[model samples]
Target chain A: MAVRDPAMTDVARLAGVSHQTVSRVLNGHPNVREQTRLRVQAAIAELGYRPNRAARALVTGRSQVIGVVAQNTTLYGPASLLAALEQTAAESGFAVSVGSVRDLDHRSISAVVERHLAHRVAGIVVIAPVESAGEALERLPKDVPLVTVDGDPHRPMPLVTVDQAAGARAATQHLLDAGHRTVWHVSGPSDWFDSAGRIEGWREALTSAGAEIPPLVPADWSAAAGYRCGQMLARMPDVTAVFTANDHLALGVLRALHEHGRRVPDDISVVGFDDVPEAAYFIPPLTTVRPDFGAVARASLEMLLTQIESVSGGALRETIAPTLVARRSVAPPPRR
Target chain B: MAVRDPAMTDVARLAGVSHQTVSRVLNGHPNVREQTRLRVQAAIAELGYRPNRAARALVTGRSQVIGVVAQNTTLYGPASLLAALEQTAAESGFAVSVGSVRDLDHRSISAVVERHLAHRVAGIVVIAPVESAGEALERLPKDVPLVTVDGDPHRPMPLVTVDQAAGARAATQHLLDAGHRTVWHVSGPSDWFDSAGRIEGWREALTSAGAEIPPLVPADWSAAAGYRCGQMLARMPDVTAVFTANDHLALGVLRALHEHGRRVPDDISVVGFDDVPEAAYFIPPLTTVRPDFGAVARASLEMLLTQIESVSGGALRETIAPTLVARRSVAPPPRR
Candidate 1:
């Protein structure tokens, strides 16, 4: 007859202990007698037995896990925000598990949620730039409590978000007050709230000042895209001032302007958002609006834990504001 | 009589179910009847019951979790590397927990590890940067298996790291081939292996060329530091070329050069390591060495999992090679 695999029972028998004793040793129970534990461990090691994590989790009925669903795209905001969030969560005795979905389509987003479900997470936080996550949220089972960061406030779920509009307004007014005729805009993808909000603020500033609002050029939040837009704007003699969606884009704009023989602040003035860590090192030391990501991340963790506690015990909502960090990328419109 | 806090038992009694049945319902076990599950959930919600994660972990003897000890500093490599590692761990049906240390000191690093132990992690991945975490590793219980990433290869434990020295060599050689007499150096923190490896590669290239090797100016992987180094170098008439340790520093060098009235490629040429997404946006479009972090991350994960399986199944050593990406920043040294 085929030999039966030496299971926990056999290991327990070999170690002269009960099966429970062998299990205690396997699961890292400190209460086990060291000598007896060693014997059981030796037996198990000799038998090549591996305890199943899933089975253990099922019997316990608590997963000891928290899930974070985030975009794979390397934007400074999301990346930094997550780094801060993970650190905070770990301190609070929670594991910060993560899933990535580039697209906010139902399947992709749902896959993230379902994967978390399979792990049986205590809670889930979705971090994405797209509004489609809202639609995807509706598909989640009513039981799981969720907290979203950098998503739409209009969704029927608890959310923690930075005040994108206020940040944009601060950036735009900084340029407008510097006496530019109308600030040109290089925006991120239309679907992103940050891009749309910045556009609105730029338009609002121009409209309020009675300056003609120029059309915004759409670009992904990359330096290359900004350089392309900067190349186009450098050709326009009247384009003496500009505002970019982010620092990377601004870097591109600066590069393109130099190539076109337009000196920054002499031929044209510029402003950028997201005063990224490297922004101050830009050739002219970028004057950009810095978002208060730390505040947002802290608020997100608080909001998520609150909702998790409330939902598991009982859902509740919270919002946060973004602050502007004034720096050197802005100046008065250059004289013709 | 004084009222006892209604624990899981009270909820189970109120919902007319066994304590185990209540646990199944709370954990979203599919076997529980929907009606009974809803009743138990309602009782739980009404009573404001919250399960202690620690208590549950104690009973189950398995956490279904993994601890990730990473750097708290916001560097591109660590930030992106952490994100990639998290995604991989989550996909493998394990929760990725995180902790960060500002330094490699035993107290700071060990504290993070002990905290993870308190939560009962299945395994750990130490993203140790310096010689410091090795001390912390000694303090940890030997039974718990660990995998180190971007750590010292000579350590007794398994290590997974990217080839920083090779990437630096490629950057220096690229400059030499571009017709530069020799490349000067700007490096990251003295403690980090990345900084040291790049410095070695640069020195090796100069030594092999039989050229005079200059002393290394230390920077903390920031643009401001790079700019300061750049300012000093720009004034040196013989310093016609430079190789910065990272892209952020290269940006600062560009700024310092621009301020010093030196035209890139015309007055001086430069190359940077870590082709950050914004590298091409630099004034002259920085030429940089890009480390294959994705390959490193993938190999690290595979090595880590392999080691875990081997230890559990009793099986060996593994290593991976690094590659480089060449970009625009290198140019011929200007005529004296």
Candidate 2:
């Protein structure tokens, strides 16, 4: 029988490793162990498997495409970040391949990462913000150039994040400075890292001021959730100031306040996070904290490209600061 | 020397054709002419070359991953549709590879499509909504199974879209039914296919009702653009009812009305389209038309998958109807 072309599987079998390991070695992924690299090299030599891209990549040193694994692409925060990432990466002469995951489970993330690997992506920028990201991230091939945006900082990976806690603190402090007795907060889902940061920041501000802390109210980062919280807060006589985790929720609160005969800033002052495009148009014009997603994406892309070229991961923990935009939504609390 | 794997160039030399012709045959892409296919087949037979994925694909006939080419993913409509597409495709057992283009130019779209072809995606779903999409889509490899979501119907590809004209007409008719003499419109960028459809719908409603058609005020789907138009309308005493292309524009119009001391329903009535989650929470609550984006996503996925399984394309021109959600924003015009 005529000899058939040696496939990636053949090289893997000769090297006594998985096909993924062969792919990793061929792609010059930095995370592969020295011993496994030699074994894969020996196998490639013996089998004479001349992968098409391998030769070109040997001269070029890296692929032009980078992969982004983003979760919740429908949400404004994630979507805007993704767009920014793409734009910045393109400016750096790299095309982006995105695989959006519905869940942050280990298997799903692994599968998506593997798909990008198969495409010979030079690096990965994961944008999943759930608490489970650390575990999921650990499962990736160690040699892959990886940087995460909006992941837990406690993890060992390089991270680029928005200072959610700081923004929340500023919002709460702004309310308290306006001389409110206390600031009530409507938070996002507790599992979200952003939510955790915002909650901590709000708590820290309240504690520092010696203001009475209100019971925690949770929302799912939806306007509907904010509206529900608004209805409940409208019934409470002492609730004069409110901080929501995002602008959409603040919108719902404004509507509820309008229906409840409460004039904004006169009856209840509200501050929101995420100065989305429509923030200025909200009924009372939301006073919101703006996270610079473009800056975050640009910074994260820089780190990822650095890792792609260096072969050794570096310590890069960068945070983008959020700014507060003063609008019409804040005032001293109405007289008791 | 160890036996070397045969490269595609070797096959092309043996076949007396270009390397691209060899690749086309290997892909089972139906675009190759019969004579060229025969020559390539003979070349493969003589050279004894078999690609890794091609052999497997011939047996399995489909890839688990589908490709989506979306333009302007940062926008709410496209982002929501992408999320919906990802969820539905996953449930149906397909991973998605997305290539977002900055522009829908033929060259960019073609490059993205070619990249997906290299990844061996089962098919492609394009979500570009610009007027140029038809021409850009024509540049795609014709043999690839393609279904367009929210594209022009005149093109030769299957399309699944929301009836934009019907939705726009509904918004305008609502204002007219509220006893307005004429309904002015704040439109999205004229180049957008949705904008064109909405303009046509709005005009149709006015012509059918015998209402005087006012000049079109253009906005670029941003609140700032809408706010500028709103300021101009606020200065006109004859502007009793207004329809905005989307809810974001309506939000800005509301802001301008408030600044100009014009009450929404009492002095003027405003209606918006796209019942985004926050629309219900807009000041005075926005009355808008709700397009079932999830349904559109689901239907498009089904059609793309069906086309992938079958070689020949089927006729699928599906339109999801939008519904009007009445709220506090519209009322009978003030007595003359």
Candidate 3:
């Protein structure tokens, strides 16, 4: 007579243990007794039973894992976002598999996405802000609920982003209201959505106030780049009030202004974005905007999880607002 | 004779494709024509073939995936190290499965290690410097090769660490050589081995130079912490030179001193460690020690990979030297 294959129950019975004990051994639980584990393993070997991960996944039709795709940038924003997401994901009942793309481009992100697919991730959180990641969204598989964190608001699908434009507008308006004729901008890379948003907001504030709009200086989100912009602005006596895309660039501007004998707020009033932890300690202290990344992380997990469990596809698009922390950096433009 | 069970070659034969083509289809190779892929998939479904990952791992006894365990700290040092490690691992043709613990505790690390084991990682790089992580090393599974990046030198297994003591000594010496009576230190958390190394080095430099060793002021490696220490030191008339655990703290000290009406170098010379990218731009610039995290990453990867490939376990214990960058922060104490 043909015999049935050995099941988990059969292995448990042979080991003289409960099914839960056998399962705990298989799961690599540390609480299991060593002697008890050895017995269960021996029983499994004798019964020729295998409880591999892929086999279990195939039977259950769920991996119960989330893939977090992030840019491999050392910028505090992305790093803090990743750390916060990881912390929350661990606390919640889910496992996170992280994949960092060399750049936030379609080809690089897609390649990472394909690798994640092989692991059968239940959902993916793509931290998109680069222009290329916006285009990469089209190539993504729509079968599962995918969310983008810190991406352009215009991008499709469930998205959670910070209000970059509002932040820029507040910064610019602060300078203009303080008696500056106009505010010059030191922006991030043009291809970045954050850069574009900040530039647009700066333009909007200047136009609304009927102030002169000076040519915007471009930077690559580095203190060195900001220093270069500062050197040029320091030479131009008319460039009194300046707004930078982020705090790092602001730092460089402060250094250059100091070297060129242009005192901040006295000679060139300056403002920055992203109140990183060190912003409060910057030379004249930095007046900047702070993005609540922890809130973004919590909101993102809740939204992605809601999509993950529901049979009905819900489109969730939300933006987190940033607040201005005024320090010693900004001052009214000197009398012209 | 009874019909033989379906095999991979049988599926290839039915699809009228080469064995390599079937492999390409199962592995989701993009180079294959769509029609060819469809034909191969149809044959596989007809034969009821399953190409599961865990099953493949059991057969091959090698997963070719490296697991990277890191502390979930937003401090730039750890963040930069993790980023560098990920970048190098990706370029080295290895899949990096990252697992971050809630804290650098043995229980948490063990739990994460269990999850990684399920993925059948070939090796592990533990970026551990906390005391609990050093204790947890003994609990790791002995079958796999494990190495710690920036961990304690006394801990077991292969280790790649920066010479924190040397960095601290140079920072202290730099302050002492500038004609200061003694250098007071603002140290990191005591539980951290990194902090311990730095403290020991500071004490060594003081004892060796016939200088008095003042009380060790402990901190959590934050700029705010440094600011608090600086506020106290700035009030003290004898506190002329101060050495901080990191550049972030140095910034806070600079700010506090400025608030207390004490000018840097002329009033109080300051030095920091981990010459972060923004160090050169701090108010007066910063003279600090620079740790080459890229070199540490490369060395750790080479050691881990060698252990992973070789049956012999070579005990590799090494330390990367840190160089001091002289900047505007340190100057000879003014004549009293």
Candidate 4:
């Protein structure tokens, strides 16, 4: 009779260690010493023992899948960030399973987490775009390795985010240097940290320049909102310059200005954030702040994986800076 | 002993069938007779024989994981389709593992597929953006359950794609009906079905109307390419109408038209496809065709899953239509 092919048992016997030790080596558990791991590996190679993932998963009760809860519907930041994270995760030999939460309510966020947990995922990355999601993530059990991207830094959970405030400041500063008196603002939704950061940065830039900060108008991150705000700004005799929270809104502002018969740069100078792909093609080619979303995503994925590696482990919060890209959108304030 | 969990042996014993027969019944193999399979199933329930997925995988050599090979870059159609597939796959209790092939070269594409095979995935979905990817996928194993989204239908693999030609036809016909003498075309990379389809539709529309068919310029799906093409068209006194393959190009076209002191609609009318979110914000809001990517994704997932179910031992192919969204981009040709 042909000799039975070597299994984990044969490798364990050859290495003079328990079958569980070989399993640990296969799973890359850090507790095993280097010598023991090498011996197990050599024995496995000699015995032709291939550890089956499904079998190991059954025994160890840990699925290799990582869940990503994102709110990427119709928003540029969230969508781009999620895509970056997916790419980063794929490079690290892990699969990111995504779930979309329409709203950041506690129930919705928590439910999404629970669904991933039911699948026995290794960890989770939450792309929390709303204020409620941060609070909900804090309410979850700390045992699971969790990292929140674009989340509030003040929140207790580990966070990886772009420096929204800095980007906003840069946008405001660009307008100031271009000889704008005061930069009128068209902001995104009120509850998002990103929105708040831009508002704060805009206020800071104005205060530092000794320019009177005008009231900020809030829009729902849509072009129509920016257009309405633009129309309103166009009517104001003293409103010579404006800053928008995102490019889409800036596009709307441009349309509103055109409708009100005011030309871009020549009539009312403008600046927007999120150098979206279409920004460079905006009628006057928008001048905007481009966030280093890829860097932020890579950093976030590394942070999450670190925590996942130390599953019963912890990680530090990281904040990355956004960059500014100058274009044709801004100009000197017209003589008032 | 935890009651030994009623292994397959117990069911086989009760049903007076071989253990392989019980395995075949559980895996839904077609070779099993209806009466005998029913007997084994009844015995399984009576004996409470729960087949361990891991052990069963070892015997049957199948993994439940579904591999989704997609492009890492940003594009509206592929990105939206992927998001929809993720949502649908989650609901069906299957894990979708993503592999991003930055290029569609045979080696790169096959390497991604091999990575999936290494994980023992049950099937794969290749979002073949370039024609080269479809060619690469053809080289993959025939036994693997595979579905191609927006790929060439010439290949024997099951396919799910949006009606690009139909949508393009609508775009071109709309511009022609608006009383344009001839419509100039700016296309995406020729290898993409979308690019080819849009070009073909535009040519067919112009031919049928007895309008002059202009030369086709290839673009890489960026606003910059469209802008370059737009700049050239702006100088032509007779270039009264244009149809671009995608929205990003239309944006560039609009900017180019504006830069050359030519006004939109009043000088030259433009129509774009994809109806990307920011399209409506274009100086004259883009009028384009919107591919129902989500519906296509849902249909693709369902079709692939049906094939898997039927082949592995359950359904049929499903196709969906694309729609057109009209906006301000197109208008009557300017009077001489």
The best candidate in terms of DockQ: 4
Q: What TM-score does chain A of each model score against the native chain A?
A: 0.80, 0.82, 0.84, 0.84
Chain A TM-score for predicted structure 2 = 0.82
List DockQ for all candidates.
0.24, 0.24, 0.27, 0.27
- RMSD list, candidates in order: 8.9, 11.8, 6.7, 7.4
List model 4 lDDT by residue over A226-303, tens digit each.
888888988997888899999989999999898888888987888999888878888788999998888988887788
Model 3 clashing residue pairs (backbone): none
Which residue runs of candidate 4 sit more than 4 Å off their true CA positions?
Answer: A1-52, A311-315, B1-65, B120-122, B312-319
Candidate 1 overall lDDT versus native: 0.76
Number of clashes found in candidate 4: 2
Model 1: what is its DockQ?
Answer: 0.24
Q: Please estimate how well model 3 matches the true structure, expressed as its whole-model Cα lDDT.
A: 0.82
Please provide, for model 1 over B1-336, each residue's C-alpha lDDT reduced to its tens digit, 9 standing for 90 to 100. 223335689899999999999889877788988899889999988975655444455465445467788885367877778777766776675556767776778898887786666556767888897888877887777756677877766677767776777777887887788788788999989888778888988999888887788888899888889989999998998887898988889889988998999888777888887778888778887888777666666666666666555555322234444445555656677766
lDDT of 4 by residue, B13-125 (tens): 99999999998997689999999999998998797555555454444556656788887535766667767777777678566667777778889888788767655677789
What C-alpha lDDT do the candidate models reach, one value each?
0.76, 0.84, 0.82, 0.80
lDDT per residue as tens, model 2, B1-336:
324435678889988888888888976888999998998888887865644332333235444567889888878898888888877887775666677888887888877776666545688899978877779888766666788887886776789988999999999999998889889999998878888889999999999999999999999888888888989999999999999999999999998998899988889899998888788888778899999989998899888877877765655888999999999999999987
lDDT winner among the candidates? 2
lDDT of 2: 0.84
**Given candidate 4, what's the lDDT at residue B1?**
15
lDDT of 1 by residue, A131-228 (tens): 78778888777666577877776666677777666677777777778888778989988888778777887787778888898888899889999999
Each candidate's number of clashing pairs is 3, 1, 0, 2
Q: Which regions in candidate 3 have their CA more than 4 angstroms from the true location?
A: A1-11, A14-55, A58-62, A333-336, B1-55, B58-64, B177-181
Off by over 4 Å in 2: A1-67, A92-95, A105-122, A139-141, A334-336, B1-65, B91-93, B105-122
